[model samples]
Target: MKRDKISVVGFMGSGKTTIGLLLANFLNYFFYDLDEYIEKKEGKSIKDIFADYGEEHFRNLESFYLKELIEKHNKIVISTGGGIIKREINRKLLKEKTFVVFLDGSFEVFMNRLEGTEEKDKRPLMSLGKDELYNLWISRKPLYEEVATLKINVDSKTPYQIVREILDFYGKM
Candidate 1:
């Protein structure tokens, strides 16, 4: 299949946003971060949305935004939120519109990257501590794998390296 767009999904702190931007730039395509899109549309940060309306409401908005974005863009790179794979509808839309790349990473690396950050405020799932976080990752891993067309281990890679790997793997480099 000829890929016109690419969707990057992974756990929080897996560098989806960073690598998505790099990949978009590398391919000369537009870049969209789903969380940022939601924030812009709602006139509120994701942290505030989660605080006031809760995760379910936030996810609804995210789905809406993602659908709109997919319809509007042709050549683009999207960095989806960590929990995007939870919804089967989201997975279906992604599969139809783009090649989904799962950024696979270790729980220890994720913990190290997320350390000292206020991610819990913006990402509700990260509120759980190390053990709980690891468990959550374990549970979500299968869902990510199920929808992924490509999987890349990002535990010890730089953003540029990951982008290079994605391009190479996709035969776009």
Candidate 2:
């Protein structure tokens, strides 16, 4: 592929950050975690951003950084926030500018990974109940699929394994 960027998109707890770091290192690419980027730029934690402003403001930040990074960088692996794919502009930009990968997983896997973690509450949408979260997942899955160049089921995979799979799928192997 000629694409210089690899954008990882998926639901929360889908291991996008871990796998993105591993894949970037394996490919000798720079790695950018969008959430961390937003936090740094805004001088606040994601939880604080949502609490102080609202989800709308936080999402605007996500869209801004998503576009900025794609426009400004190359040969970088970007780990996007779960809801980043919700915006049509982001969807188009990611699909066109990068090899987008959707890390698919079951709700059980997502909940298990999130359970007992400090980072759980930092996710603005993590406050939802199982049904609400499930509905959100259902709604977003198609959007993720829409923009993805590759999709990997991550339910039983470790970070290293996921990286290898992505590498193979991306034809880097």
Candidate 3:
């Protein structure tokens, strides 16, 4: 594969940021956590953005920044926000422009990963509680699978293991 961008996509708390940093470092590429980039660009937290402007507005901002990154960078590893796939434009970009790695983990896994963590608090969706978050995960799983160039079950792997898995597979490609 002609490696340009590798995007790690999954629900919140699936280790996208952790593994993305490792992947970028291993490959000597720039790393951009989409959420962090958006936060920095907006001069506020995502939690605050969702609180102040609501989901629709947040989604628009998400789509805009996503396009900017896709267009502006090639040698990059982007850890996209969970809700990014909600937009068809974003999905098309991922499917066409980048090698997407779907971190496939069950709802239980996701819940366990985020429970009582700072990630759980920062995510506006998680504040809706388990049922809502689970539903969101369920809905997005197929979308992630649809765009994924590779899917790795993340139930029991350490960040290092997952990063190695990605690197090994990407190298072969």
Candidate 4:
């Protein structure tokens, strides 16, 4: 069976937004970035939400909006926040509602993607030092793996290449 919705999951810098955009363009589906959606709906940037309301509040909002999106949308490609898999309810929803793909990359690759960018500083979790970031990545990786219907290792792949791989794999399915 072909799922109407595809959810892209990964740690930060794993190219979820970039690849999801390309994949949606290729598939002629609507593309959504979960964080951007949340930000728009809340009328605040994610950084502002984190700063003012904290992560727990942001997470609750995330769950609410994700459920809303799943219930309301179809033929869409969703690029999810890195920590979306941290919640069991979100995991259950993702597993049951969407064809989820996990995009994985090495720590070095993640760092490289994030390097020399002021935008990177706006991410709430970016306050962590190098070791902490690596530890967080390691911890979250297994969760991503557990929820994924398909897993793509994106160590050296460009966004277009990743989209192509996803399209090919999705076609085979």
Worst 10-residue lDDT window for candidate 2 reads 164-173
- Candidate 4 — what's its lDDT? 0.91
How much does candidate 1 score in TM-score? Answer: 0.93
Model 1 agreement with the true structure over 83-147: per-residue lDDT tens digits: 99889999888877888999998988877887787764567667677788888899889989988
* Candidate 3 residue spans exceeding 4 A from truth: none
- Model 3, span 1-173: residue lDDT tens: 54888899998878889889989998999999999999999999999999999989999999999889989998999999988899898999899989999988888887888878888889888768678777888889999999999999988999889998998999888
**Tens-digit lDDT track for model 2 on 8-50?**
9999989999989999999999999999999999999999999
lDDT of each residue in 80-149, candidate 4, tens digit only: 9999999999998998899999999898998888898875976989889999999999999999998898
Show model 4 residue runs off by greater than 4 Å.
Answer: none
lDDT of each: 0.88, 0.91, 0.90, 0.91
Clashing residue pairs in candidate 2, if any? none
lDDT of 3: 0.90
